[model samples]
Target: MDQDQQWLINCLNASLDPNHQVRNFAETSLQQASLQQGYGLALARVAANRELPFGIRQLAAVLLKQYIRKHWNEDEEGFEHPIVPSNEKVSIKGILLASLDDPYKKICTAISVAVSTIAHYDWPDDWPELVPFLLSLINDQAKLNAVHGALRCLALLSSDMDDMMVPKIVPALFPCLYTIVSSPQIYDKSLRCKSLSIVYNCSSMLGVMSGVYKTETTALLLPLLQPWMEQFSSILK
Candidate 1:
């Protein structure tokens, strides 16, 4: 079993090798071994490992995403086959979240995307605990990757949220979101813009909800252009 797992990591790592033969060999190995259980965790483990070469890590992350999208889901038969086991999920989340503090921008982007994918499957019902962790990170200014990854997942969650839950979610969500979008003092311009984008998209979704949420919609829309508008007229202000 240990040999099989190490074999999978080797295949993923080979993609970074300069030799075309080595790279092709790795690809074929993955294609063959991907059918086995525990493959998804192996890929994610490689991606989250800081000791690995960056290029190799990215290949692992991409494979992990592909593996996840193909296999893990709310199945038709309602059977449960978690390719990433329960204990592993917690450990993986911690690694991915901590990877947000990585200095490499590309690594940060990759980790954020992986986190977003995990949130898609785990949140709404399966995992409510992640919400608080992400929210706390969003409020933190010192760590850009943590903020970016957290906000990315939150935006993703809101995008697919049920209309029925809008009332319950929007009131709590908007204020934290507002704090991100409204603050010019935050060092990251990208975070500022992303926060506004979330507000813009969520506002539209909220707008279509029941009459009771009309005030919430109005509250969100009022600041729709403020962040970008401030940027366009920076000298005047």
Candidate 2:
């Protein structure tokens, strides 16, 4: 490991220390580190390092999520934190998605939250490949960990998506969600439920979009409507 990464691991370990002063000092140092250019990448590396103690890895993932939320975007109203540098943004985005397949559920959840937060600012426009990348993961049923991570992030993103985003996401996503939700033999209950939640949010967005973009939205929804309705009825039963 690089010196900075090792130091970061030490700090993450210290942050969990029972000693109040040690923990506080480590947290303060981490907060300062968050201002630096490579801090997010380092945290991501630490979080994804399977050899590290699970607690430290979990803490790193949590801190990484917090870092993305606080500093990823520079233009939000009242934002004051230093923006993540462009090069570092590219590197961070590249590594962030893979960590979703982390064996630790807590770490996966934290990374999913981080990915969703980044998507809020960068998806489609800055990060055009994200939807397709996530869709690929969701479609790959052989990798359940990746599928779960993708679904979790999509569920969060779908909840807050804009109408413009709906058209891009709904067509590709609805089919995967339906497949998972409808096939009890293939996906377990939790995966089915998460997929269903994303479907609900995407459907809600589709409803909102139909009001103004009737022709386009109808075209998008026409193929998926019957299957979704059937699944909905099954769930209600």
**Please, what are the lDDT tens digits per residue for candidate 2 over residues 76-98?**
66455788889988888888888
The runs of at least 3 residues in candidate 1 whose Cα sits more than 4 Å from the true structure, single-residue gaps closed, are 1-9, 18-20, 74-84, 211-237
lDDT values of the candidates?
Answer: 0.68, 0.86
* Candidate 1 lDDT score at position 2: 76
TM-scores of all predicted structures: 0.76, 0.94
Best by lDDT: 2
Candidate 2 accuracy as TM-score = 0.94
What is every candidate's alpha-carbon RMSD to the true fold?
Answer: 4.3, 1.6
lDDT of model 2, residue 125? 92
- Which 10 residues in a row give candidate 2 its minimum summed lDDT? 72-81
Q: Please state the error at residue 235 of candidate 1 in Å.
A: 11
